[model samples]
Target chain A: MPLGLNSPQIVLLGVNHNTAPVEVRERLSLSGSNTPALRLFAELPSCEEVVFLSTCNRVEVLVSTNRLDEIRESITKLWLDRGKMDSNTLQGALYEYHGTSAIRHLFRVASSLDSMVVGEPQILGQLKDAYRMASEAKTAGLVLNRLLHKAFSVAKRIRTETRIASHAVSISYAAVELAKKIFGDLTGKNGMLIGAGEMAELAAQHLIAGGADKLVVANRTLSRAVELSRSLGGSAISLEEVGDALVDADIVISSTGAPGIILSKDQVKRIMRPRRHRLLFFIDIAVPRDIDPKVNDIDNVYLYDIDDLKGVIEFNKAEREKEASKADRMVEAEVIKFMAWMESLNVVPVIQHLQEKAEAVRQKEILRSHKVIESLNDEQQKAMDVLTRSIVQKILHDPIVYIKKGAQKKNSEMILDAACSLFGIDGLEDTQKLQDKCLSDANQDKTIRKPSPN
Target chain B: MHKFLFQITVFIYFVSTVGFLVHIITLRKDAERIATVVLSVGFGFHTAAVLMRWFVGGHPPLVNLHDSLSFLAWAMVGSFLLFQWRCKLKSLGAFVIPFAMIIMTASSFQSKEILPLPPVLKSIWLPIHAIICLFADAVFALAFCIAIMYLLQERQIKKKRLGAVFQRLPSLETLDAMNERCLTVGFPLLTLGIVTGSIWAEKAWGSYWSWDPKETWSLITWFIYAALFHQRLTVGWRGRKAAIMTIIGFAVLVFTFLGVSLLLSGAHSYATWLK
Candidate 1:
């Protein structure tokens, strides 16, 4: 069946880390458990399907609608009303991608290429959750089903082929990486978090995730330290016991807000003496680093300050950016595949029309021959039917193949024109006015492949 | 015929070296495959040349400096290909294969005549000692190359100016692993080489403890590597420091292998320049 000029068009409009600040994004964000995707589907007139993706970094609404610009405006207004903000205030925060670019954007998002920390694995899971929500709400139809599944495969390919997600791109992650470089593995290793601050806690989380089982949280405030330790399921220690903790710690992350140094070079040297120069990694992410800078001069004591961690993160970011170019090529190749499939959709209707016209003519001729032959029995009738059907199929075979190949190349205009004129099919050329619909759809599509059939 | 084959091997190594160099420069994908295949063919011909020399002379060709140099180059190429296959580190070729080319080029300048083997060189332990030492040397050469790459990558990471070379090179973790792997394999072979050479020395010279310059320098190189491995095991000396120490150890070993025999007189001084 040939889709008319009103085939479902893809429209994407939302706020991302790049397009909006966290404050603005939070105002418009949808919770995963209670997404208003189905409500959004009901609210919009022309929208056929909707999938809303809301994460800590981005909030995107992907919809299939025949009215692209109208739905885009409606979505922007929806965000403004939902945010309770003025139009001008929320105007620049929302970015829109339509048709194929919208799909490419979705692919990039699912692959984590569009993430704040590119190649972080969480976005794929988050996208999957959003997809599941849309599926449950029945707001995702055939177009979205194919697009999302294709996106998942693209994400998987990007993850496997490139080292985008293999390296750490955050300060806490860099601390874990340095620990690996020092200890080779963190299993059963001891880690100390000095200060129980947010940064210290984050580093501690990364360490635990990387298999450092033994953790000690130390801070000047004993109660806060104890609280943090209880939350993280680790033992708590007072700031005074940091030296004692340092002796057993293979990885130490200190992010205390204190102005002076927490561990002096002499204290570190003393700790080293007992351990006989065991490796101790210190990540001082505080503004004024907790550990003395000279502590790095001590044997087996590796100290990396915030700036050093930043350097690691920056290097990793550059590496991911390089990998993104490779991902871009893969996405481009996939888009070509998808566009070819879509162009093949155009050929489907023409093939159906040509088949219909041929069948109609075959039926009319058989009836006329049946009336002229009075002695034709049932056996002879069966043979004549087969003979006529085989001739029609043979005549239609070459033209069908030629039309399909031309359609896949998107050179369907000349071939469709020639085929329609040769076959004397009437409604298709008038439906060529409906080519305006296909033309507009193709315009919204990046690889339009034609100007006009007329 | 053997000499002609040897020359062709050297020529092929030169071409392979150029191909790898272009791979690093252009970042072309097929260059590594082409270069590796070419280098393997060269290694095959070099092997043929060695076997032909062995059959014609009625002995293994480890008699003099000329023969030893060619053998060392052949060992380096063979081990390089082996490691390259094992690790899939084609970029390492850009750093290591040049040593084989340089050794073969230097070998070409030396005497090619099949001289009579000295009575001292006739011991079976001579070939064993030489083979183990050359194998160890080949591994150390790869370690040196990886160490160089590690330092370059580390500098780029530290300076926060990751550019073309940094992208072409492997990660710090990968380079460090290669260095560690080489040390793990090379150190034991070096121990065996030293042990075999000492037994041979005891038989030939009546004393195994003579501190000839080559013997003294080889011990020095051995101790340097030993200390490097010890620090890595106990104190976790790795990354930039580890890389730097490997490079230093390679330099000392090169001096022990070539400089001692060429520039300093020793009981094992058979590798003097051709005259």
Candidate 2:
């Protein structure tokens, strides 16, 4: 008596990388704002089963909707309240999807196909957490339950089958990717980290992992320098000591938020004089860039900026793309299979009724035949009854085959109604009457478990 | 037949060189293809002309500098044609055909008349010196092409000019592999040529180490190439540094082939095209 998976209609509203900046995403961050939103959603008569996914690159609210217009408006108002602007203010930046499009969009988002980095796996987990929070608040229902479960399964299929999620996820990883392509491995090489900034720290960590020795971190502040030394397990040197440190530094990464060039062209030239022209890897990650752009003119010097790293980043992105395509194909296949299962759901009750009626017929026919066989003997009558039951089962087999075929090709409901009319069958009416109660009981506040092996 | 074929071969070479130079300045592949076709025509005629000279002169064409240079260049054209057939390496011939044409044209300036040699040139070393040196020189000429490509490719990569020509050029790793393969094959052949030349020197000059201008320059060219070979295998040298060194080696090769004959006075004066 499960209430047929009657979802309110599906609706999707979101802002993504192209429409919103980091600042906009930070303002609408779901970090501490879910409580009031959940209460408001429950208060809305038409809204049910909400899954809110909020990440740095995307902000989306997917919810069940019996009233599509009211839900789309309500979701847009939430954006308006957060931005303190008119609902139409975000019109240019916002995208809305309904029905099957909403389902497909959510599958894409949860699968990371829509991610800025594309193929990154965090969004799926974020999506799962969002669904879990909704279920806890008693917002999710039968349609939502099945949809979330399918979304998770589709995401899992995509990750396993596609190349989208096949690459490094962090800044340090991208840096290492670039270095590995440049010099296969940095074993036996000495590297210097300048300015203990966040970007420099990340690059240094990757270089050390790549088998390079962290010779020193040259910084302006000594106490902050000592912290970097203890943290990185490398020596700390004063900013004045950078020039002295240049000769032995094979790979120099600088990320100070300096106003101008920290390592000038003249200093690198002076350094070249003493080093007998050894190879130099100058990585600048400052906003204005720490190293001079002209330093690339030096022979044997390989200088790379954030923009230069973009090419390598794009390569990593391409790797993700290849994996994503595989994942997409996998998702497509699973979606087809899931759709088939959904269609099968349609005729399940009719098939169940047909099965019940067949059993009743076998039981009645066997009882009648037993009475007729009383003339034979006690053991012979039982044998005759068994033969009668077998015959009834065989007689019902062809109709059962046609019913199953009808379930697959035509609508299950249509096939079931036709079969009921033909057989003059009128049982299981109680099941149709108890749809809401069954749906509520079936959902019963249980979380849809994610369907991938840990 | 030999004379007429040689005229046709020289004509094709001249036209193809003009075609390539114009095409390169225009940045047109259509023009380049036309140039390549002309070069192929030249090669066919050049091959026939050499075979005819062999039939008419009654010996192999490697008897003297003039015939040896022409015949070797024809073999180089064959090598290039075979390379193009196997791989999409026609872009290479745009640089190479001009070189082959230069050698052929330079040989043309020298007499094509058959002349009997003195006792020194009359020895069995005549064919041995001509064949080994010329064929090995052809391989080195190919190596020279790869080296220049290596340098240009490196510059384009460093400058981040990823244009059609840049893309059309083989990958840096691929060019390095090709350069290494060519050097490896050419180096040993050159070594053999030097060894045979030393033996010939001993028989002709009564001393193998007299340091004739051509001999001295040949040894210098040999030393440069040997250094390049050693550095690549042992020192792991390649890319820009290796490319520059290769350019330097080619300069010395020019000096050995042209320098001793053109500017410096030497016993190998008969090998000069200036005569």
Candidate 3:
């Protein structure tokens, strides 16, 4: 259904990793609390409700307003002013969606379909935080409160219904996944870290999280090893002790800056006997590789350099994309449902006003004929009251049905206007207020009821 | 009646084998459960058939090639069921059930006639020697399947392919542990089987160390396993090496159990008994 002039419309404006380069996003990114941004948006003359969402990858403003163009222009100006950037530099970087598409975009963002790394979970949490900030600032009124909650539930639904977020898509996580495949469970397994690189440290942390019992950090600089080990709850050893440590370590991640191979096939082979040929996994994430490629040929020794981990990430990325298409369809279906809810909001006020007017007229006429009622018996007066109420309800039933049915059609605004004018109810302002109350009541009911997609 | 039950057992094994294969392809939990349940039912029928044969023939049903093959299938299923009860290795049946089905089918093809027990076979050591040896063979069969899975999974990790087979198979460490467990249990039983067979042979044929084809091959198989067991204990020959050795040992064991009887003329040959 097309929105009328007076009906509130949703508008989303943002610059994401896809639409802007890192430099541009960095300039536009709102890093901390979004309270100031929420207040600024709420103070826009035409904007009724707002939720400001900002993250490392995206900065977005979701707003409900009567005048979409005015709100869009003002928000864009305010965003550019906040980022201290001129309009010409960000002209091509900005993107906007309106009405139903805006709802769809919010859903996609909430579900991480719009993330730089699609299906990453942090965006949903960031969105929730932004929404909470807006709510605390009293900037997120009925429309935004309902919209953000719907977005969260949609994200939850997609997460459960599809395998979009189940696979590991990062280097360290891929290492953990492969480790699990080779070792089944990493519980009580020894892990050896042979470098102080960030990626290597992260991989070691993931191994520890995956239940590896102990970690040994061996680096050329004993001080760096000690520093890293202190944070990881692991022991630090000199580089000379790596050979001895290899015998005890079940999983080894080597990212040393050595120009040549640090662990060779012969060394691994000699240690295999001492290791009782237990399965040994090596993740060599360093450039110019720290472990020999032929080390994998040694029985029970598995070595994966950076390229292999990337290959795994690529495979998992493809798998996630396949699941993402399924999630997209779910989001599309939900957007339609929310749009229908918005459409029903249009007719709710008119229907309420028509019924209220009929009841008021009935009560006024009853009061006007009080003398005749006083002349009648109490039982007759009771029948007179029931008869008048039933007549009013019967009279309004067909019109209410007509208005609800019309709301689902393309000419809903026209039908609504005709119903309002014919009833002599100049109720546009009253309609807005009534719709807000109705939506708030619906929101309360939503919290108390089971969360169904419908 | 026993012949009919054996036929039913074979049919049920074929069905369960299909179920397990489907489970491997689809990776459906219900398929695995149904396959396990159906295999248990088939094992029940197989046990009944073997017991019925023992009662009717007045022997332990270890006389001819037909009875031996059927009994081997029964032993394999029993051991597999025992393992299934203890472990969570559900995909194992995909590799194992087909082997049992093939043996059952082979047993069905052989003559089902119940011959009178030969005088040489009429001894108290018959059941003990045959049952222990067949049970050891069953355990070795389990190791063989587990070894194959280990190689497949190890190949995926080393090659870094990580395909569908990689996803379905258990971890290399778990498979190797299962392989080691099989060896630990199967080796002692094999040693005891050989000892008991030697005793029975001396009592029956007046010789314990015959150069018969079956006896010689069994000795060779025993030596291979003994070496593997020794190295595994002392030097830690595990994972790929252990997996390969388990496979090789099973091959030799199979030849001693089957090829010696079918191809080579020996005291243990069913051909001699049939004559």
User: Which candidate should be chosen as best, given DockQ against the real structure?
Assistant: 3
lDDT of 1 at A70: 81
Docking class of 3: medium
lDDT of 3 by residue, B80-153 (tens): 99998997774899999999899988889888999888787899998999988989999999999999999999
- For model 1 chain A, give the 10-residue run with minimal summed lDDT: A445-454
Segments in model 3 whose C-alpha atoms lie over 4 Å from true places: A1-10, A26-35, A45-49, A64-74, A77-91, A98-100, A138-150, A153-169, A261-265, A329-454, B1-85, B101-134, B191-216, B265-275
lDDT (CA) per prediction: 0.80, 0.71, 0.85
* lDDT of each residue in A1-454, candidate 2, tens digit only: 3323342455677777877666666555544565555556566666776767677787777777655447766766666775565554367567776654566667878798877778877888888987887788778877678888999988887776554665565655665544543344577667788888887787788888889866588888988878887888788899989998998887788888789888888889888747755557787777798899998887656677877766656656766776676666666666555444545554556666666777787777666766576688889877877886777678777887887787666355566557767765664444433433433332332222211211
Model 1, position B117, has a per-residue lDDT of: 70
TM-score of model 2's chain A: 0.65
Model 1: per-residue Cα lDDT over A60-131, one tens digit each = 888887765488668776777666667865676667776667777788888888887789999999999989
- Chain B TM-scores of the candidates: 0.96, 0.85, 0.97
Quote the TM-score that chain A achieves in each candidate: 0.81, 0.65, 0.83
Q: Sort every candidate by DockQ, greatest first.
A: 3, 1, 2
DockQ for each numbered candidate: 0.22, 0.06, 0.66
TM-score of chain B of 3: 0.97
Model 3 agreement with the true structure over A1-454: per-residue lDDT tens digits: 1223355777777778776778887766644335466777788887888898878888888888877447767877776777777897676777777767788889999999877677999999999999999999888887889999999999999998787887899999999989998888899999989989999999988998999999999999999999999999999999989998899999899999999888778888888878887889999999999998999888788999999999989988887888889999999999878877788777876787788889999999999999999899989999999999999999999999999998778776678778877888754645545554443333332211111221
Docking outcome class, model 2: incorrect
> B1-275, model 1: which lDDT tens digit per residue?
89999999989999999989989987777888899899999999999999999888877887667687888888888888888778776378898888788889998888888877777678888778888898898889889988998878666644545457766777565677789999999999998888898999999898886998888988999999999999988876777788889999999998887788778986787545211
**Model 2: which residue pairs collide?**
A8-A65, A9-A65, A49-A139, A162-A323, A162-A326, A162-A327, A163-A323, A163-A324, A164-A323, A164-A324
